[model samples]
Target: MSHPKIANTDHDVIDVIRARWSPRAFDLSRPVSHDVQKQLFEAARWAPSSANEQPWQFIVADRFTSADGFAAMLAALNEGNQSWAQYAPVLVLAAARIEMEKSGRPNQHAWYDTGQAVSMLTIQATSMGLGLRQMAGFDRDKAQIGCRLEPPFEPVVIMALGYPGAPDALPNEKHRAGETQPRARRPIADFVRYV
Candidate 1:
């Protein structure tokens, strides 16, 4: 069964931001189309970057669309992550350039900029009624080889995307429960400090 709607805390926030959460169980029967895929990346392409240096690249593989693409990427994931991520119809390896192409110097904020891009992508995906789970459980070295990434493009997170599947399909009961669990956030007092 599809998970029941998950509501946000009483605090006010954008509907999309509140609704966005990672889902491990994907309805692999529903394939993500190329057009929708383009839209997701378009959203990422517009995210802000330091000095306008967009340093992120996404290597996407769709099991439902491309032959052997998804299987190849899956091989790069850690054994544990492969268990659940295999169910997702789409897999993406996100990488960030460590140096700016224009300046030819190290870009200290490249990773941070890439995160901003991924955030935009997630919001766009959520708006389109799709779900994604981002995992850092892959070996970076192996991902570099699997993704065929060259120097300067360091792998970061691997994201799985597709339509949400029945929570009951998940092996762990906790994962099923998490699909409906009330989202939590740290209090501002816990992380924010007054100067």
Candidate 2:
């Protein structure tokens, strides 16, 4: 199947935005370069945060070529997700710490801010010819153990990042069909409520 064609522009901004999509299948054979990963993280670092707290932190486990700690982490993920997620070159555990402490009261905006950071990182990866899938189906306690996460740092999302792979390789027919589907979004009227 032919991939969607993107038009060239002075900066390719429009094409990048339009072509961005979550890809479940990844090319496990190809190891993502450190430079590329660094660039993606750099883009994430600049995302807006409440009060510039910049609370997001990432723990990356390179799963493509290395087996160290990879299996344990994969095991923590839901069995249904393991098939495709195992093929990703990198699995990032996005986390955030509760920053504000006023007489034992924890701030509520930290998670919200961290989510924004993840969105920025994913979009940057998409714009750079890479694919990312944010996942929440995992054993959080096991993941924290496998990823070596400490207290006060709560896991928000687990992300798989790598080059796109053939849809035929998916473990199930449903996933194969989903890989080729066009991007869908809720209608603007459904979301925008003018008070």
Candidate 3:
């Protein structure tokens, strides 16, 4: 598989946006530095939200120092995902609260707001030469127990972040290919409707 090439564009934002991809294989030997982790969270903190509710909450486990906690969280993941996810230096469980009062006593767009925060963090990680995979194939019940989550906060996505490793180290060739493939997107015409 060929490595994806970054397209040169006038807008600097496009460079960061285009470079982001989910890599399954990671260099487990090198742990993410505290400074970098703090930067990633700082980026998440600034993500736009409805009325600045900042509903997103993150539960992070440093694999090297918190092996037991990390292993417990990994136990809940699907076997396929667990194979690669276990190598990530940091496993972050992102959650958001459902704010009913904000939407006139109805369930507001908490999930949407949480997603925005996740996207921001992912991009920040990517820009810093790290790889990230946002996974949903995990046991929510076990995650809640392992992370000691409280009420009002629901588990949304589990993000694995670390420096990428060789594609050959992955579980299969398909995953390796996926790692190097250029990200595909729906044509703007398909999703955008202009009046």
Compare the candidates by TM-score and give the number of the best one.
1
Those runs of model 3 whose alpha carbons end farther than 4 Å from true positions after fitting are 5-13, 100-107
lDDT of each: 0.88, 0.80, 0.84
- Per-residue lDDT of candidate 3, residues 72-121 (tens digit): 88887888888888778889999988755456443377889999999999
Error of 2 at 80 (Å): 0.8
Best by lDDT: 1
Candidates ranked by TM-score: 1, 3, 2
Model 1's alpha-carbon lDDT is: 0.88
Clashing pairs in 3: none
- Cα lDDT tens digits, model 1, 129-181, are 99999988988887888788998899989999998888888777777787777
From the highest lDDT down, the ranking of the candidates is 1, 3, 2
Give each prediction's root-mean-square deviation over alpha carbons: 2.1, 3.8, 2.8
Question: Which segments of candidate 2 are over 4 A away from where they belong?
Answer: 1-13, 101-105
What CA RMSD would candidate 3 show? 2.8
The TM-scores of all predictions, comma-separated, are 0.93, 0.87, 0.89
